[model samples]
Target: MDIEMKKYLTLLLSGMSLIGCASSDDLSLKQNILPLQTEVCCESASHFPWFRLQQNQDLDFELNASSPVNQFDGSKSYFSAFTFAQQSGLVEIRLRSLMLDGEVAIPQVELLDSEFNVVKTIDDAFTVKFSDAFAKNRYELTEKVDTVKTPYMIVYVKTSELGKKVVVPHPAKIRAQESGEPMPIVTDPTYLASNNGHFSLSVETITLSGYNQKSLVEAKPEEVAVVQKPAQPAIQAIPETQSYYHNAIRQAVESNNIDKALSLLDEAKALNIEGAQEVFVRAVNAK
Candidate 1:
């Protein structure tokens, strides 16, 4: 082969090798904690199915979990999450875990100030659960008053077992319950001032595997679109009954007869006409 051809082929092969390695790295697995917006606590393992927080709420303590099956081979890691909003005076928390052995395993919890010094250490029985199974046990830690100026709280756990204590792979997140009842919905500006303050929890989870660059890969085939015949146009038809009801609804809305509009909406919904519910909800919410 010519010298120029040989040099070009060597460069091409090197590029292909790098591309393959990158693709493999992309497919490699990792763990991550999906952060919650508003603060909410995980009431139980059953709640893990679709646990999340609201838009305006925040969390004081949160558990960010990964899929249990995705846990590292021998690394017994702990997740330390923090709250978003600042708080003064006393901050409280309740801890509970799935029983590992015969006795209930008390996970070590520390309340730290802004400088990471241990402000308070808590390991005590504060509440009781009726269930004995790991799934049924409830751990409680309350009345953790700290004098520090930090806005974050850390809850960490590591296994004492020599080997990996293989619990279900999914990481579980929990938060301290709110102290007061939620504020009621207020529609008027004047009435809004009477609404009391509502507190929320903030929890964040970070996955160690997501940081591994070697396992990141980018190997995938680009999509190739194939055009086909367009869909057949259907007849734009309206039944006589529906036409009459639509006209009546339009007239009622124009006349500002809300009851008549609602009654028409109920009839239209029962008929299950296309766009009936959408139009109805729009009318109802408009007022």
Candidate 2:
């Protein structure tokens, strides 16, 4: 072959090899994609089938077109119901949804009593987090529930979250960046808001003993009577007493007299002292 023809063929073969590598990478990603749900809608909340949640065990499920649609706050969306098999003291529940395949599920929770009455509603609690092991992003929410009052919970998508998108670094691009590749292909793939995706829920029982003992103390009848005594007349602070009030609050907090420090704070406010609130907060936080 002539020298010019040989040079042209070499360049053409190199270009084809690059194109083949890119195609292979795209196919590999599609092949390893996680499977999504294809079921129908669940029943209404009152008669909905609830999956039993066991302590310290993780349960995974999906919400799709088959998931039940319910009206909440005047908007319709899909939901899932769950009930604890056994609970005691305070239980911590952790919920997470995977952001995969350009879709994500934004979840809110409603805690219900035995009569199916709403006890507590939780929203805007899920925060985006990354998982290195799975090379994927997830939205996670961790909340403590009092099992005595609320034993049932429902996971649902809020109306406000619909059409919202979560921007995440593409896993393949992240790998390229981490490998120190020059001119690495970088893309911020967005996961669209959806009521369909994979999620996992886990529960852990918390011991009451871990709480502060002072907060659990109840006042006796005699103590209540003592507290009901007439209050002393308020002593107004003189003008230009800002420094005095600040020092007094710091001293009280240093002595572990939180009540006295708060009383000083109220007195300072009554005197229209500017920056008194900031000083009081700083003192308390320092303690």
Candidate 3:
């Protein structure tokens, strides 16, 4: 083959290889956290679903869970999770209860084994010492003896009876992020486990929604073309911006203030401030 033909063929093959690599990368398998959907786990009638999240990286969580379907007699059992990373030494959490129920009954937090046996009870830290209103602040739990070797964790919580059945708004938040070391954030111990366990044990196996993270991929295209008008440019001190007529016209045009600009042009025309035709054009296009 001629040197010229060989060179052209080599360039074409290289280009094809690059394109193939790009297409493969785009289609490669990559796991990612999807958009979170929080559902409640209830007893007797219904219960909130257990959510699963990988340890480490952060995902935006919305704690806006639905209220109990049956307020007369309703109890919930939910299991939220975080996978243990190799370097995961501590699990940090920020637990808060919603005020929909009108009152607050602190829930129980337990670290369970693969078989769902309680390894140890993790305390839900409260801000105030002696009060029903427990502040949802940061809490950290570190492995005292050695690292928790549970391959599968069942971070469990069951709803309580507050003397009377009080309906709550959103489900209580049970956030646990893997921390290699202790964070510098300060925490207050408001409630202790040996302090307050659940009113009763878990009644039965209630299956709620499982946390299935939606992958973060290319955004879906919109059907309609969205034309976002740019912000109104600040009025300058130049001739176009200085004159009351010009300023009013520009503001109107930029901010869809066409009527006001027309009114200003009418007033300017009445005043006869020179060149009626040029003034109208300049006022209309107040760049």
Candidate 4:
């Protein structure tokens, strides 16, 4: 090669070496940023502990502690869209955290419209605790009229404290408007704990003809009342004396008082109660 060409080649080699080193440095930096623990899991539909949007037309979100991270290492955080729905340009969204071992500082919640476009963003700082035994949060957002378009959406949950950041994911998809489907009667006792003590929350359009309205929260008192239906009715099948005893047994089971249930069964057995077998089964199941 000519001397000039040889010099050009030498310079090119040096530049390529520097570029490779920079790329390696970048990879290392990312590794360092991830959490040290392994097995970080974020929320997903299959493993999600809790999530519900009253209205299929409304936006709702919940964060999970499980996040799929790099190497399935607990250090990496993941994100998934919990709920995304918009019809007639109005949308309501709710987001909450399930709590973690230590306090978690959540920094942002994002909303992606149809077509994977980022339509809304909210900034908030909150700490969550699973040990609280209850969700101590309720955040909401209202968006203007817009058709549901995004098939793939994501929620960005992150906390920046001690110069470290952790994110969890919950991917979301669009579904048919919930208006046609009958709203489930909130008769399940478990629904209250899962839905922030609200037996039901709905997402519906305000205007029937125009897209000039907002999404509103809809709930029915009947739903709550049904869930709170008295236990007296459940034991009505038995005689008066037996009904009283059965009521006590049901209460013990409901309270998760296994010992009490067993004790009540023994008490009935001593009296040669006719339903001793059924009562014993109920007591065993209570435990």
lDDT of each: 0.32, 0.59, 0.30, 0.34
Number of clashes in every candidate structure? 31, 3, 16, 27
lDDT for 225 (candidate 2): 9
How big is the positional error of residue 106 in model 4, measured in Å on the Cα after superposition?
0.6
Tens digits of lDDT, candidate 4, 155-190: 433433322323322111111122455444332111
Query: Which digits, one per residue and each the tens of the lDDT, describe model 1 over residues 211-272?
Result: 22112112111000102221231223235334434544544443344455555556566555
lDDT (0-100) at residue 279 of candidate 3? 43
Candidate number with greatest lDDT: 2
Candidate number with the higher lDDT (2 or 4): 2
Worst 10 residues of 4 by lDDT: 188-197
- TM for every model, in the order presented, reads 0.28, 0.52, 0.27, 0.30
Judge candidate 3 at residue 185 and give its lDDT.
47
Which candidate ranks first by TM-score, i.e. highest?
Answer: 2
lDDT for model 3 comes to 0.30
RMSD of 3: 27.8
Give Cα distance to truth, residue 219, candidate 1, Å.
35
Which is better, 1 or 3, measured by TM-score? 1
**Model 2, TM vs. native:** 0.52
- lDDT by residue (1-287, candidate 2, tens digit) is 34653454355445545545565335323322211111223234555445555455566666543334556666665567776645344789888888877777788889988677899888877888876774358998889987666767888776576557789776676676789766456677787676556787778878442223212111111100011232342344433245545655665554454555666667667666677767766655554
